[model samples]
Target: MAKRAFDQASQNQPTDEARDAYLEASRAGQSQPPETEAPAAPEVEGQETSEALQKQPTEAEDDQQKLQLEPEKDQTEQQQKLQEETDKEHPEAEGETAAPEEPETEPVDFSILKNGTVNKGGNVVNEDGKAVGRVTEGILKHLIGKKVDEKGNIWSTDGKIVGKAEPVSESERDELLKEPAPFESFPDAVVDKDGFVVSNGEQVGKVIQGDLAILRGKSVDPDGDILDKAGNVVGKAVRWEPEPEPEPEPEVPVDKSILAGKRVNKAGNVVDGSGVIFGRVVEGDVKRMVGRMCDKNGNILSESGDILGKAELVPEGEREGLKEGPFAELEGCTVAKDGTVVTPAGDIVGRVIKGDAKILFGRAVDEDGDILDKNGNVLGKAERWEPEAVERKKNPMSGRKVNREGNVVDEDGNIIGKLTSGDLQKCSGKEIDDDGDVVDYKGNVVGHCSLIEDIPKVEEESPEDKEKREQAEQDKKLAIQMSVCIEQCLDKIRPICKMITEKIDKAERTPEDERDEEALVREVKPLIEEGGRILSEAKGIIKGLDPDGRIAANAKHKSAAREATPEEHHLADVLKDLTGDVTQCIDNAKRKLEDMPHAKKELNPLWGLLNEPLFQILAAVGLLLAGVLNLVGRLLAGLGLGGLVDGLLGTLGISRVLEGLGLGSFTKSLKGGKKKGGGLLGGVLGG
Candidate 1:
């Protein structure tokens, strides 16, 4: 404020007249380095600038002019007005004419802000009224077409107003000079060249396999974020959805028997040892594939691009130029001249040295009768396996047999079942399965065994013979039903008979003094009643089966007409006599009991013999059965009914002889029954 600047600039010191020329130099478009001066006072910083001096009055003018503050003056204008007043008021009071000197400085921390100054206006103004505009945040970035100082402190408007100047920041200028910037000015996005897969701009996982990606080593939904097993979000999923489930691979049919054959020649043709081509590798290499069905290494393309099977893994050591790549794992295996795929172990897995071979289910197994997998687990047994048909001269029932068609055949030439591998079971003493097969002890189906019905030599019959056969079948069924019902009735009858026999024994064991007629009557009545009912039912059933009394309906009353038609006629005659025997026994006991009321000292002795009626009834039944069987033997001469009857009777475990009756010695009784006096009643009751 003391040393006032004039309305002219400092001259080169040629003369006082040079002042106007210096002022003219400051106005012209020229750049000059600022004069290095001591640090300015807190105020009046604008008065020290050369531009201010160039606009100020000279000292002579300053001595005469008076200065006053003007309202609405900015910092710069205020400094100018105050400096003029100070110099005119106190011309030589301060360092106004001090000698030029070098200024000292230190590297002090630089701050764009002044102490206690609020930076609300987004600028730092020095005392000299110069604004420091840097792009600290958002200030002065859009000052287009203007130049900024190299230090980014000052803006140049090229003579324009400071506030209205369109000055540009260095960064903005640098951006303009660069190639057209990417569409994003700031570009908040970033990328990491690695395959951190993204979906909808969110990271999901990283690629591991060629087609697979994972998050935290686990699968994630590609359409969303990767969730941990607990459902916490680990990351977002990448947008790689599995390729649209490629249309399901088409199923291609390939003949599997081709695998049993020889390796193909280099020309892809299967040749014999003489090099004659028997077959050509139409699709896959014969060295890799036995046929279209082989899955050994290499494409099995039919040139038609139909994939028959997947390329199988060849052995590690033999993969190099091995022609029989398919047999790498199977040592000692060879394609026989007969097209048998023989293993090194002297076993054949399939047949035929070339083309398709049919390895029989029969005779293709180890001695243990077990079919083992490669891992040695028991898959099954090829029990009693047989050889080819030409070799099958031995009895089949002696063992289980397998056929070429993979069926298990029993010794009787019947197909009992099938097996994927050879049959491995014995055929002795096994029960027939529902499938008409004799299963091994392990329950695996062996070959088919002959059924009971199949054991008969059933020949094609004439129409009349067919009718008889049908009748025989019907009779057999009806007989079975009748026999079962009779047994059930017998089961009921036997208990009653047993009870009566026990009562009789008790009566005989008791002393005559201790015997009671009332108690005996009560006990024997129920048994006699129930036993009578059972006998009646059994007789009714026998009659239903043989209504004509064992004689044919067409038989006349005389001559050969008296010939018995079936043994069932004998059965009915015997049942009638048995009924009479029971009735007479009951009548005799009742008569003896009536006499007990009068002769009180003697209880009826009839109760002691109550068991005789049961024995008589049973003997009569035996006689009936024996005569019927003998008559049947004569009636069905060549019809093969004897064997069937035997089988059905076997179910009851009954034998050729009746239990109480000696049927073999009944010859006299049978001959005598023709005469009325010597009937079944007399013979069975031993009269």
Candidate 2:
């Protein structure tokens, strides 16, 4: 009976060995929760007594039954063990292996699905949230049998499309993990904590923390604080400021007036602050305008102008005598209040004298302010008349003379002389001829004139005149020759003198450290000697001449000799004057040269040659002629032709030539001759 019951229980268990093992396991652990419901066994009607099956007596029967039970129990335990082992080995079949990987959950973003089906908006996303066409095996395999929408979309708690519910690369999976956890800590409301935010009902795609948004050109900061990358608050967006504008430069004022008291520069434009202008004032333009101020002809005069200064005019009629006396005075020369009274004739600058009166054709008035004669006779009044010159007259017969008023006369009624009558009274000459007859104004013999032939005839030449004339001519020729020599000398010597002078100047100008005194001296020594010799020679020549020289030759002698012809006298005078000038020049040169250092030191052998007795004798001959020339020069200068001396000085090599010879002192002395050369030797020696 027990064996039948056990067989029945086992049969009522599952055909699946695993289910049956579970039932047995359930039964074995009472501490465990009830794993299976209790089973109900159907009751069976028994009619029997098979003594063989029921009886328990014999040892063989007991042993046989025990063997049968052991085999059956062993079979059942083996089947149950195999079943449990299979369940563990194949947990998927048991509905327990990792729960099908949970479909590789993504953030629950329903926007990736369209209601119950996937739509265009439900496009799948890669693990990085970049939109993709569909879920790949690489992504799907990770979510093997997990629940997924029909479109294979997966969702996560954060409502974001983190990844698709499919097999994805391990790298993709890692990328998904790195994404920020959803902002779900807050809420799904469109408005954020700071202000309003518009989010799609679906997913809010990648939202970076710092990017700015704008609406209607105005920057919007939904996060309110709008923190920068460094987490510092930045203000809302604003319009940019325009670049700073550049400044403009000021303008310069222009001057419009041409003669606005300013001078125009070479560029022809007027500048401010310059002094006034004085226009061209050439001779003959306007004499008074010489020093006066004027603007350009057409321009307006300056406010300060009335013509700046007074002008002195030299009229055309006065030009001829301009070189003499008051006329010769400079245009602006001023006369002293005391006056220039000392003249060649006498000091007549302020003296007054009365003279016999006659009126030829002039308006005249008498001493009493009436027109009358001393005899109480009425003289005719005149608008114009000639005035008479006063004179003293004598009667040759009585030795008596009458005064200018005809008051004093010889008592002789013999008619010695009569005072002529006119608007003014005057006296006529009383003459007595050899016959004791006086000649009247008509050439008639009114009275006898005495010894008229006894007077000298100034037109005839005298013996003394003849001699002086010849000498003057000789003097003049000598002067000409001397002048030629001087000129030639100056021409030859000027350049060399300039060179020497420049060299000396250079040496003097050089710094002390750079100076070479010995070299400079040696170089100049010979030149100095040459100049000295020339000067000494010239001096020697001058000394041989007479004291006054040709310049003092007797003009009377020359004039007398020339009485035969006027032209001859003029020529002789000129020649004599020229000779005197040459003589003086030679002396000047000599004195200047001898005084030079080189000549004094006697360093030049050439100087000895110049000093030779023969040369001296020859020079002596020239001196004799030079003396004559000197006299001639004086005569010529007195005759208004003295410039010959200047010509000679310039021509003479003496002074200028000496310059090259290192005779600067000698040159200076020669130049000084103008003041000292009153006499031949005086000029030379003084120089």
Candidate 3:
């Protein structure tokens, strides 16, 4: 029963025989006691019997079972061992044990995927957020779902340590991921993190809109498609080529044949074959023409071309021969080249002998031996010439000579007037009739010319006579200069004298009852003072006349030695007279004023009439003194003692006073009369 039940249990288990043997052995061991007897079998069903068999076992039966199970047990042990080896070899097949629960692992931090995708289009970036290389499809497949270690190293799903995760800013990561993983390839160029295309560390261009690249100012697509700024395709990029250098131009030659047969004139003009001036030769050397006119061969030619002499050499005035034409007649006659004078009708009048045509007919002849008519036109050239004699007539009343040319001469051979028609015309514009009387003029006849012998011709003077003549002329000029000086001095004195006289006369004319003594003194005082100034000026003039004292001393010495010239003696006498006269006049005028009834006494207003006679005498004396000085000055100047004249007239301010007195013309004459050569007063007066 136990066997059947065991068989039944093994059949219900797996079909493994070794496992069934081991299970039967295990049942036998458990059913049998250590010393139990065998038991009977139950006549029940297979299931109830198997239950009973499992519930109780007999002692004898237990022993029998041990004996039987021994070999089976060995076999079961071997099979059981084999089966445990099989279960070890195939734990998943049936009753495999659950793998020992692995320790609960922490969730992987895939935060690196938040920064960028791990795909073929991604970049393998470095710590700086710069792509070191592209994320290839193989690299992406190896790296997907991978976690980064604390060191940023990424391990692949296949356990490979592939890439690293760099913790970059959000913006930087976004910027890096905007472009495709594998950037466009350009020769010697790459895109930097800043989207600039760099070559050999220099930024050559920029990447715009993530993929549009700009190079050399032109837009370029990732595929190297070149485009305009408006996004229109223009062309494709090509390899760079350098431009070729330009070639030089060839030089041209100059033509100088144009200058052939040409010559430059002195006027710098270039002349051609026909002697026509073309242009000027500003530079370079060339043959020059000689004269104004030239032949075709460039030879100098005369004006008429027949003459060899250059026309330029002829004098302009004589080129036309004689200005006067060949006349038909002259002086009532014409002359042939043979010196025969003929009438206008070709009749032979006379023959010129020895060129003295005047002898033939008393015709006029020029010094050139040319016969002339009365109007001085040349009739013909003569071989020789002589002047015609002039006829003279005598004036019986005046005994003066008159000539056909109207000159009238006195007996002394001095031309006094001209006789025109019947009247004698004087230089003064007065006429004298042939009756020896002044005609139609108001002048008395001071004298009449007497008949005298003809004057002899003047001979050449001797040296001594010349000296005397020159000395006389010098003395006359000196006399004139001195006279002018004295005249100017008197001119200055005259006005003061007149003013004094007039003032004194006015005082005298005043009625005694109406006379103001103070007024009379006031008016007369200035006049008296003025008279004193004139006296002082007169003294100064006398002193200036002999400023060096040489003239006075020389005159005195000459007079004592009796060696003085007549002029010198005269000068001394006139100077002495003038000095004495001026002194006496001044003294008398002073005495007259002093002798007044109240002259030296203090003014008594009551004695106005007494001063009247005194002023009148003073005025009369002043007027008389002026007249006396005038006479003396005129006499001294007339004597020709002008060398003693002083520049005191100008020095004492008398020239200015003369100008004011309307004697300006006289003063100007005196100044102008100063000789160019030094005179007595020249150095002193700035002549």
**Candidate 3, 249-313: lDDT as tens digits:** 66554333343445456654545557455444433332333333333333343445542221121
Query: How would you encode candidate 1's per-residue C-alpha lDDT over 16-102 as one tens digit per residue?
Result: 333334333222212233222222112222232212112323455433322111111232243444445654565673353334342
**Residue 595 lDDT (model 2):** 31
Best by lDDT: 3
- Give each model's whole-structure lDDT: 0.40, 0.36, 0.41
Instruction: Report the C-alpha lDDT of model 2 over 349-425, residue by residue, as the tens digit.
Output: 22111222333122223322233455756553212212355564543434443344332234554433333332112
Model 2 earns a TM-score of 0.19
TM-score of each: 0.24, 0.19, 0.21
Prediction-by-prediction clash tally: 31, 63, 10
lDDT of 2 at 392: 45
Query: Candidate 3: global Cα-lDDT?
Result: 0.41
lDDT of 2: 0.36
